[model samples]
Target chain A: MARPLTLYYAPFSRASRGLWMLEELDEPYALRLIDIRKGEQKRPEFLAINPAGKVPALRDGDRTVAESAAICAYLADRFPDAKLAPAADAPERAAYLTWLFYAASNIEPAVMARANKWDVSAYQASWGGYESVIDNIAGAVRRGPYLLGPQFTAADVILGSMVRFGVSAKLIPNRPEFTAYIAHLEARPALQRAIKIEAEYVAQLKT
Target chain B: MARPLTLYYAPFSRASRGLWMLEELDEPYALRLIDIRKGEQKRPEFLAINPAGKVPALRDGDRTVAESAAICAYLADRFPDAKLAPAADAPERAAYLTWLFYAASNIEPAVMARANKWDVSAYQASWGGYESVIDNIAGAVRRGPYLLGPQFTAADVILGSMVRFGVSAKLIPNRPEFTAYIAHLEARPALQRAIKIEAEYVAQLKT
Candidate 1:
């Protein structure tokens, strides 16, 4: 028998995004908690798995994938039965990928800019600055129940996590569309389970 | 006959990254220039194609994909004959996607942090700081030939463009690996063509 797919995770961190994805897949995946609070992720042992020494690196067989969006995109494609992603030939695939990249490439930088109060010119920053990024995101969520309309895919897992975190932390604008979108995402049983799992892990760490 | 896949582009801009990928694909792709210098990308007409009002939005049939990395990933998968991406089942696919997201997510943000001289904490900014990002990049290119061994995929287009830009601007370290990698990438006829195309476009604009 093959060893189960595993996620190198840490509770309350970006790794939770991967945790949510794993739950959504509803597949049996092992969790190896890297005590980020103790900087376990930066340790050599974990560094071997991820050179960047970041948590949320998913290992399956001998292959390991890091970067939260990449992990979600990888799993979604690897497990087609889960229907967490569009088929490569599907028309929606282009939009699907666009959102995934947008979440990471555009959203994250914009969030950081806002947090750090950086005076980033729109031209200099490929993300086009925080206000435009939020406006684009707001426009995206406003059009639907999800980023790519009716069907929810891993793009949501990637982008939704950022929006959810941003909105909750009072960093992203508290627009009605975002609030509604967060509510919609929060209602997911998989997300609920992931939240419970993180809480449980944190509880155990505390004990 | 189907309309040729169109790339909404701006010479000497991030869109050039998409142009390089299109050239690498060696397919008939139409270029619709959105002059960034004239602020054409910000116009409502261009915004209709890409809500973010950014150039490098690729339009195939009715589907339009933006974000340079997304466009490259989409094209690579869309045209498998180009061999610009690993097949979904291929072992390298995970790493391919990892690098794609890494270039966009990790690399771009790190570049911004460096250019702006922002005091970004590794914990907060998530690119792990500019030094670590460069170290990781240098390590990858040092392995040589290409990002994923012998196969040169769209990951290179996305990341290479950034690395090339960084090195030339002296923003990235003057490491031997990166310098050699840029030289290797520069030798590609497709990149040369892309460069020539940009130069020609600029000349036309000047006239």
Candidate 2:
């Protein structure tokens, strides 16, 4: 048997992107859900894996990778068959890589600040505040159907995941631009599978 | 002649990382210093190139890459002769890619929040607040000399830049572990040259 890849995740958390990444890749992996509500993630054992005490950490063979975007980046590179990540020399790779870092570095943080109503100067914040981020993202997708032109790569998976979170949480307004972008990626079969899995997980939590 | 790589830089800003990245690669790149103090980065021409109006944006060939870490990631892959990034299949690459995203995605935001004294909860913040970000970084470096075992790749250029920013800004204290880790990377000649250049630029401003 292959050294099984394991992801310590929690539904509806950032780890959903990691889970969704694995789902998109069609890879064999085990989902080890860490219950944040019950304080399971804070346990010593969990900290041993990720001192940050966050989900979306992955145990692949002997190495471990954490952070949602990081996990997705790793998976894209690790599973070359998925072609989720562009090759090093591909011109499209520039936009692909930029969007990957941009999502986590700018979009996520800015959205959090916006929802919390923090008084940050949009110009000072790397993400340029929530509205600027929305504008920047809209401008990118308006250029094409996906971030990297026509390719619906892992960058989309991560960005789409954040977009969905933003919409559902009402942090990102339901602007026609964002809706259209999400609609484009949500139409993918692999993404649908991951959504179904999360819906089931959410239902289980309710019952 | 080589569609010269140009970095839109500003002394003491995140652009220093982009400069250091080019310096480390031994690639000749033009420095287009944007005087953020004079609001040059916000100039219509500059904004036309990068709407974020941030320093440390890069124009390589016909491609433009913004976001400090993104520029570093792009250069690492674009100019592979530098050996800054690991092969796609290398196990260490996972940790490498993870830390690159971590620096920009978490450490930068968390440090900014701390320095500004933003009334943000550590738990709610995406970077998990300042202290957690510091602790997590310490744990990663504690494992080895670098985030990716022994190799000093482009990941170091980005992370080292942030570590230096953190300690200098007093946002991240002069913890012995951090100081030691930075000492390991700060000893590099390329970094030294970049620092010297920034110092020169700062001196010019004084006059």
Candidate 3:
């Protein structure tokens, strides 16, 4: 029997990354949407599930997973038929891990810094200067239509979500490469479906 | 033949986490120590391997994995026989993924903020303030002998490293739980072995 998966998510939060992955995998999951505006994420019940009280927490049977990148990696590995990640022993697995962590550690922090307008000393910051991170990302994207080249893996899902968010927030300058990459990712049927569903959810909340 | 694994590292850097994991794996690996103070990580040759110029980048054959947590996860998955990670299909895998990402995303950032004495609105920060991050960590350890109950996994390597670093920097309070946890982790033969080798490297460089 397939274990049931429950995702505690909020619309337009980082949880969307995991939602997109679930769509890509075509897995049956129950989306228990928590409204961050209502302070639902800070409720004691929610805190028990994730002491961090962040959105996009996943529960599979008795196990709960938080952190968008970790959730995505876990799903990809658990559903090997999706092939969203390389096999553990496959040589490509190293690159797979590299990009996955890079998306979270490098790209995410860089975006946050830009969004918050935080002044960070590049020498002490692990992601280097914001410009360096941006240049590195552009160089990587210039290498292909996807982060790992032709084959789209789970890294693309997380990276795509981040890029899309950045572009929407004007955090990433509207460069030709950024525009093309976002378009390429949005063209994915799974992402389109996820976005559509999220849009409907948002619309429902508005009414 | 097993694929070659090489770690680009320097003693006392965050890369020590990767070195500790390599020792735990008991796998044959070449350690190419890069002295950060000498700007070796910024050299063109090393830059080609990791433009991020971070220590603890792992090269497995033609593929390179960076970010200490990512490298730890990759190695655990790559050498499944080491049982450093929960089985991909196991529900506990979610817990493993959660804490692993937590170490990087939450703990690392919090430590940096504390170390740099950066003051920002905790509500505005995604990490939910250093106090919360520390509390969450202490809560997790108090539930321990390990992050994942009695079973030690790569999450421990990641968390253990952060805990040790945090305590040393006085970022985390030296409470009994924190002290005990660090002692438990440092006492591990693998960590001891890595530390011993790193101390030797540091001492050699001094002369």
Model 2 lDDT, residue A186, Cα: 80
Pairs of residues clashing in candidate 3: none
Ranking of candidates on TM-score, top first? 1, 3, 2
lDDT score, candidate 3: 0.84
Predicted candidate 1 versus true structure: per-residue lDDT over B32-124, tens digit per residue: 888888889889999999999888899999898999999999999999999999999888998898889888999877877888888888987
Q: What DockQ would you assign to candidate 1?
A: 0.87
Residue pairs in steric clash, candidate 2? none
Candidate 2 per-residue lDDT over residues B69-164, each given as its tens digit: 889989988887888898777778777877888887888778877777777875566677677788888877875577777888888888888788
Backbone N/Cα/C clashes per model: 0, 0, 0
lDDT digits (tens) for residues A30-144 of candidate 2: 8887888787877999998887788879999887888888888888878877889887787777778778888878887788777776778866676776777888887877766
Interface RMSD (Å), each candidate?
0.8, 1.4, 1.5
Please report how far candidate 2 places residue B27 from its true position, in Å. Answer: 1.6
Weakest lDDT window of 10 consecutive positions for candidate 1 chain B: B1-10
The per-prediction CA RMSD against the true structure, in angstroms, equals 1.2, 1.9, 2.0
Candidate 3 chain A least-lDDT 10 residues: A108-117
